[model samples]
Target chain A: MALPTYAGPLERTWYYAFRTICGLIFFFLIAPLVVIVPLSFNAVPFFTFTQEMLTLDPAGYSLKWYQDFFGNLNWHGAVKNSFIIAVFATLISTTLGTIGALGLSRAEMPMKTTVMAILISPMIVPLIISAAGMYFFYSKIGLAATHIGVIIAHAALGIPFVVITVTATLVGFDQSLIRAAYNLGASPTYTFFKIIVPLILPGVISGGLFAFITSFDEVVVVLFVGSYEQRTIPWQMFSGIREQISPTILAVATLLIAVSIMLLASLELIRRRGERLRGITPS
Target chain B: MAAATTSDGALTTADGIPLKASLARAERRNRNRALLLVTPLFAFILVFFLMPIFDMLTRSVDNTVVGSVLVRSVPVLSQWDDSSGELPSEAVFKAMVLDIQDGRETRTIGKVGTRMNYEKSGMTSLFRKSGRRAKQIKEAPYKEALIKLDKKWGDINTWRLLKRESDAQTLTHYLASIDMRFNDSGEVVRQPEEKQIYINLFIRTLKLSALITVLCLVLGYPISYLLATLPVRTSNLLMILVLLPFWTSLLVRTTAWIALLQKQGVINDFLVGVGLIGDDGRLAMIHNAIGTVVAMVHILLPFMVLPLYSVMKTIPPSYVRAARSMGATPWTAFWRVYVPNTVSGIGAGGILVFIIAIGYYITPALVGGVSGTLISNFIAQHISVTLNWGLAAALGSVLLALVLALYILYDKIVGIDNMKMG
Candidate 1:
């Protein structure tokens, strides 16, 4: 935390000023999440900013809402359905994207830019148009209200994230390594698994995490394709907010934020390991 | 080569030359593998995404409702386009009565009428109730029959609806989306000089998006610079905090802001405690432009931060140090050396936030009341509440064009070369 050797009086003043400014921005960025962490512990039903006292009030904190979210059948069902959809969509999108990234990045193909753009187009186009179109088509096929329908719909939305992340990782990839494996008489499949996959594993995992979260958070498409039983947690939360302002949503939101922070921490960890394993030094 | 020889032995010679002579064959095989890898994505997008959009766009010109069912009665209706240029011919009126009586109505004039009505109002029920009374046109006197229905029908507006029914190929929906309606001669006319129309909404949405983009740049630039200059460990931790909300469900984040911004929410509670305003004074947080700005800025802050951070991280400290060593003040050095370098991130982040903000449905829908509704909310209304795809598609198409236009404009102003998005 010490200032560098070249620091002068004015430079020292500027350093403190910069640090203070950065610290304030950091607080502002994290303040909302921080606010929710404490509020979730409030025992009272009303969601006031701070509890009764300035001191720590464990009496105001109870596990009732968390218990309610778990014990309630609707919340549990939605959570289960969200996990199911997110998992399937994640696997499908990540697999497809990884393969596409491998081919686009490694193959000596024509029109690579065109292919990459086409592959990444889903991310740019608005989902509402896609949702409207899918609703009509899926209705005709009688798949509009099915769980499979929503999963496929969400997977299409998530694919671009996987493609973007994996492609970026592939930019640093050493394709000759795969050729080296093949020269050793390892089959193409074996080389792929042992060589290419390991090198790009961080990108793949990070991309998969992004894909999973994208599908998990998606609401508009699910609203079009998913029915009551197929409702995910976001959709349930959406309806809950619309029907009434429930503090229980706050409890759920806080839990989700915590889980997201955990996931992000793991993703960052995976990325660091990935960079180290691939011998690609980070800034 | 050995793997290929073993795996594809049938296609290769003993000398390891493939049966195909040209590199084109290898190219073809590679292309096929590439195709195989990309096919799933293309097919998924095609079937689930593209096909549906095409179907929705098709609704724009789908005049089947008027073309098929009402063709038989048009002859009689054409006769009434005489002298007064108002009422339909008596025989056509009689035919409509019969058509209404038979209940096997072929034309979906009803659907068209309802579609137009949602973009405005007083259409479906107005038209449906009147259409049902065709039989009464014969029994009752013509004036009585007309009076019984909407008096607006007695006016020229009724003829306008009927005329819309008469046209087999109509661009009325497209025109209406731009807040234009067909004049009596079927020329495009602005929807009165007074009432706010879709054209205004289009402009408003753009203006609102631009305002938010500017707000984000103002709020995000300094933070991004600071994050960039900090030690990597500290900056990375800060960056994660910024990105933390992105991992949570967007719906949850928007609603959390809603809880915080509501009249009885934390913001209002704080304002009241501080005597910023009376308890009963307008919170004016949610359900207005203020709420829209707050929620959108929060949702989009990470987008602005990430790009700026990446750009700043790449920038060397020497530029600023040199500026300072040359007798420049710290602020001057920052403004001259650091700020210009960060413009690329600023532009990239601005575009990202603006485009995403325009299409936002949840935040605007939740926090923005009537005054703050964006174009997406109307698109949702068309598809879900009104079940009008033509208008929805037209509105959606307009939004798509606006976003695309902004992209090109941003590229022009900022020079896409400057962008170094991570």
Candidate 2:
């Protein structure tokens, strides 16, 4: 139900109290992020407000931190590593997860619920257990501390997100379309590529985006399975803070935040388009 | 015409007109295609997911030293008063002592001690000493030597811990992690009153999780409500704002808090500038519970808001108006009506926040000083610093058990299937 915005005197007071409290909290939630965007371009390096210093003071407006972030080999390496791992992991997880979703959606497989639960368990199970286990198992096969090791580990973690998003999209899918394609003598592979893939492209893309983000942002698992050569941005950021808190990290954070916002916006667009493709308008 | 049709039907029985075999082959091909489609995923899971969990569970019961040592002393230790939890026969104790000592001399004690220390402290030294010079227990001067090693040896509790260890299988590591000890008489009992630990840490973790969950809900609920009600454009913008932090890495966010919350950091600077307290008054933000709560809440609020918003969006406004028109005051209407309807959302959000908070490691380690560290921190220490996988696994098992228990309870109370927060 639409919440009551106004009421009798006591009710009105309660309403205002709730709204005021909510507004304050909303500000608190967004404040840290908001602070970073401006601080990224701050004339002064310190996080503070100053009076009447809008124009580029010779020292204040320097983009040296940003320059260092892009120019430093360490930072550049981390960024490249993160993107490579994220892209590869996302592709593997989205492809497998979508195929799994299609199979489960159409068939009345035995123990279907259990299979689904098992697929999603990675999301629920604590990372430490998984990380420790992976460490031991991977070490035996000489996969530990390798880039391929980190990618497989991340893809495992990313698989659940892909499954969840793609499953949701597949829920309302029509079976009759598949039957029609079969009736027209189209091969199943041809039908999937020409019909099902385009129909569920939104779900697939959204799922892929989440998988990419999940792998990009993951640190705890990477921390265990990876060593120096495979360090991603978050892992680097972690050590950066531990060793020294430089403004260069701030520059990195601001850049990462910008990239994340752009990715999320694109995801939202994909969601909107998928909804439209499915003939469901945004409410 | 009828006679001709009958003759034609009789002639059409076999190969020329039928495509049944082709249809059957096509179905077989479809089945094979499905199998081909799913095999890659199955291979990935087998290699990556299932194998790891199998390895982890194996470590849970991995009793390598005790297993190898079983044949050497099981028969000799047989004569001891196991029920009294009394110290075993001198020979058996001697064998154990020698084993422990030899284990120590060969540095096997360190490896075996990893499992025993998980049960209780000082076990490695006791076992190593007994193994090396255990035969001396038969000598007349045994009491003095025993007492010299540990004054508690004179008491039955100490002997009880030893007697408990004689078993072929060991729960000592698992039980001791939770602060329960075996009585010498061989019954499991609460760790003697003085040594009970980890319980408090577990409690503290729970309380911390509850506190963080509450803080997130208190802060996130109204914003979620507002976001749900705002014009679509505005709500979408606000939602993006909520999700902005999520795009960045968690390590980055926790580090950001470190930058913001340090003693000479912006928070302290702001407090000093505002005259809230003296310039000398350093606000205890990071390196303590306050810092942990603040940083955690900031990171976890999105979990709360997204669920709350999804639930809030579907709720039509007409219910509130209907309540208002039917002789109910607005305040009464909201308190009785709106809030209860939002319970599912709150429940979904609370569960998500609590589950995530319990598994928190990085934020607590980075921001939480000794006093602020949670149980997961100790589990990490057991693995990383101490290289004690047995204890680490036991502690992890405990944490895993608790999380699973809470999950089961939550599911029973409000079916997990009924809750969704994306």
Candidate 3:
């Protein structure tokens, strides 16, 4: 808001001070994330900037850490496991969550509030508690230390996001479209595929992205439930931090930062698309 | 036709069904379809998610180790009174010797020892040493031989401990979780001064979580106000700054903090280069309480901001403008009009941040040194390092109770349906 011409000196001073505080807060949010990008390329294995780096000398930077990350067999295995588990978990959670969200958004659904709470409890409960419980129970059932176990656990964790996003999209949906399609002689399956799926595709895809990220970044549950054979990227990074302080981790963090940026951009796109489909213009 | 007729002039459908029954049938079909769609997920969560947590709750009080392993002695010891100030009869000693011998052969007596050790120290070694000598004792007056082998066997407290732990269900783990234990007379009391830790850790966790919540509000409020008041295009652009961290990998953000906060890291190097302190005086920020508070405030600030922004965006500016026009001071206008409207936002963000912060694990473990560590770290340690699953489960139950309570509060203040993710 622009200052009014009749504003007093005190108002003017407070306005500038407020903006300054917000600027610093914004810097606090973004600086740590941006600071690591430059450090990841440091020529030395250290975490700080060197004298040459301050002067913008090309000699002070190197891609050796990236090379190290790419060449390590353990990192490769971790990457493979991360994608495999995340992909499967995302698929399972997306399907189950989409169906559940449909029911949750229906006006006729029974015990809707309690059911929603139970469905979302995974997101609400502490991760450590979930991990400990899963470790004991999974061990008893002969599922501990197995890839399938980790996958199922991650899938369970991812369901809430899918349920949330998809149900949000369904909230704005027009139910009459389904009835109209049925009146036009389309079968229930055909109507769902044509009318419902197409309309909610954006929500489903964004929800799937959420589920994917949830699985990919998860470490605690995998630490408890999986063996070394199922080590994911975050698990590897956890041990890497604890066992050895290495610059390669910085490189990996940089890569993950890139993934986050891409995901954020895609989520924005999906949000805008869904809004447009629902005929809501940006203010 | 008469059976289908209603005395109160109820309407009938085309098929001679009453109109209310026909409407009810349609509604039931819709409800069944909705329930059908949801059943698979509900059942899946029940089996995979809820059951495991319930299993852990059961494990917290699952005390069958001593009962099963020391089968021969539990019954005999249950009859002997510890307050009598006398040793058990020879039959009791005979039962103990046989039990120890059988446990040693089965290689399961160590579990009993570990469980007992939680109640009283030195019981593990007592059990192991006694087991080794029990098989060799082949004489009458087994009590004398057992006492000669180990003076601990003759101690009256040893029998008391055995009697207490032999029950199928016990509250000892739960007691120890809160730093309370059964005294000599079986009354629950605080642990010895040096041994009291879990209660303090719980307090620290709550205190730190509250501090972090307050910090997030202090930092988040101004920015959220700025975003809410700015032009839509500019605010959307600035919103990226908040969402980037929200979307970033938790470990990645934590790693960045390590790079920034370590003694020799970026912040220190900058300070040293500017002559703020001697090179040897670089601060130890990482692995401490300061590090945890700083990093977590940065991480959780977004949770505070988003809710506040959404709420603030809905508040009409006319009320504040009207207050200013009515001769109110700017501070009064903002506080009396604007701030009151934002209290719901504060409550939602506060409880959300506190709930998440209390259960935080990775950030504290990575950055929080011994003094900075939260209760979650201890729970993890018990699970992985100490292999004390029961204690971990007890601690987790306590933590879960806390979070559930807060979560219910959050739902009351800000409905879960209103929880939006960026």
Candidate 4:
């Protein structure tokens, strides 16, 4: 990355300019996220920083927006629904995804490419199309507006993440180990729980995390498939932004960011552990 | 068919089981287990995901509502040809009167009017007024009486529109979605100027997506280059900045943009304090196309950076160093030797970002004010408020088709199996 010793003044200027541009671009990536945390604590019901905030006065900040978020029943209901739906969706998607990936990982599996494409189509297809489709179909089956419907729809969307991550993990699995377990007189089920599960636990956990986050963050399908009783946090935030611009949403956004940070950190740790398990090292 | 057999003249496995029957059963059992494992989720997705979309697309052309609502009159009206531009006979008008009365009695006649309004404006009030008046008249000269009630009933064009939209399935909704519709004489034609919004919105969406792709490349190239060229320790530390937003909640990121870019927002406040702009001159940044672009670029930047960074990291730096050592100037070596190598990354990043940006709804709906709503918003509008699911379905199909085509191209360029997450 160092410049040549014989560089002219023009070259030196351009080099510094290029680095400055990159610095600004990096700042652009992080500044919005950083700016909102402080703004969410504003004492006034405004998005901008007040003069006192700039002067570092303690009076300029308050937790009233967070208080508002907690006190409001609509927000409370949405948060509750978000967790309930996400948990069940994660459960279904992870269970189905693990088994599906196991089948897909088999070298003997027929039409592997076609099946992979079919399983992952939910991810590739646009959410609007998927939402529109589910909206009509769920209503037809009398599942529209039900908690189970939204969960099922979200699970469908989450399945691909599980399949992709779990399949990636399964790629490094040694099939000979399974054969050895069976040859040693262990039951097929026992071999799976004892041998396969231990090796793929990290992938399964990470895949479950992906499924959970996907369900939690989803809004489009919920908008179509969910009724008033099934409103999720993202759904509420969507109507909030649409109907009213308020600081309560900013507060919730900050809290959601905290949750994401936790999820991302866990994923990073899982990736490292998975790599170690697979005997992979950075080049 | 012949099977491999042991010297004992019996089909058998190496372990001495019958090879022909045993091998076939084992293979069948293996396939059954695989199919069993996939069946639950596959059935779930087939029922919940694919079925609804297929049903929705089918809804785009489903004209059953209008046909059924005006069943008695539609067949009668269809007999009147456009050759003479003549109003239908009194029997036709009487049938229309009976159908309108029956529709109002059943409380389903409003649907027919709504369907016709989607085809021709002002048909809503026309149906409403006639339905109310149709209940009052019992005269034999029903055509004149109906015309006297409202002159629009006498117009052949209204009857033509009614007959055109009376089919059990029609392409009217699909045509309307693309800013085209059938004229009164049954010819395809452009919609009126005021209603010609969707075609422009589609064009604008493509243009903005392209612009965002360009913006992503411009801003992301330098950042990816820095990350790729810097020491591993520094690059790894810097990589977190890119991944944080990548994993962050989309609504949170959009809200962050709103907080930063709205009128009286942080950026405006800061600029006002710094005397860069007057207090009244606060930039309208958040509720316009610019807001959509700025926030979308921020949200989608990581997508561009990850692919570009991955590709750049794989390219050996020695190639450029060798080019320079061989008397290629730094500029020449960088462009001719270095830039071409990142083409794969650019293609991957560009296509991924463009496809996502085209289908984006939340950010655009929130920050993109009236003038900024993309085609996806319009589809959502028809789905929800307008209650025109047919048009919504048609628009959705177009979008779905467009995305699938682009995805196929992307798969061709960069194998889907090679897609990775950081």
- Lowest summed-lDDT stretch of 10 residues in model 3 chain A? A274-283
* lDDT by residue (tens digit), candidate 4, A29-118: 999889989999999989889988899899999999999999999999999999999999999999999998898887667888878877
Candidate 3 local lDDT, B313-404, one digit each (tens): 99998999999999999999999999999999999999999999999999999999998899999999999998888899999999999999
- In model 3, the runs with Cα more than 4 Å from the true position are B1-10
DockQ of every predicted complex: 0.49, 0.42, 0.83, 0.70
Full ranking by DockQ: 3, 4, 1, 2
In angstroms, the error of model 2 at A73 is 3.6
Better of 2 and 3 by DockQ: 3
lDDT of 3: 0.93
On the 0 to 100 scale, the lDDT of residue A43 in model 4 is 95
Residue B226 alpha-carbon offset, candidate 4, angstroms: 2.2
| Predicted structure 3, TM vs. truth | 0.98
Which prediction has more favorable TM-score, 1 or 4?
A: 4
Q: Of the candidates numbered 2 and 4, which has the greater DockQ value? A: 4
Which ranges in model 1 have alpha carbons more than 4 Å from their true place?
A: A1-18, A50-58, A281-283, B1-21, B74-95, B104-127, B130-160, B165-169, B274-278, B407-422
lDDT of 2 at B401: 76
Ranking by TM-score: 3, 4, 1, 2
Error of 2 at B373 (Å): 2.1
**TM-score of candidate 2 on Cα atoms, chains taken together:** 0.84
The lDDT of model 1 is 0.75
- The residue-by-residue lDDT of candidate 4 on B1-422, one tens digit each, is 24557888998766677876887888888888887777787887787778887898899999998778888887877777755778888888888888888998998888888888888779889888878878888867888888999999988888888777778898988898899988888899999899898789889999999999999999999999999999987988889899889888899999999888988888998899899999999999977999999999999999899999999999999999899889998899999999999999999999999999999888999999976778889888898999988999998888888888998898888877667766
TM-score of 4: 0.95
Alpha-carbon lDDT, every model: 0.75, 0.74, 0.93, 0.88
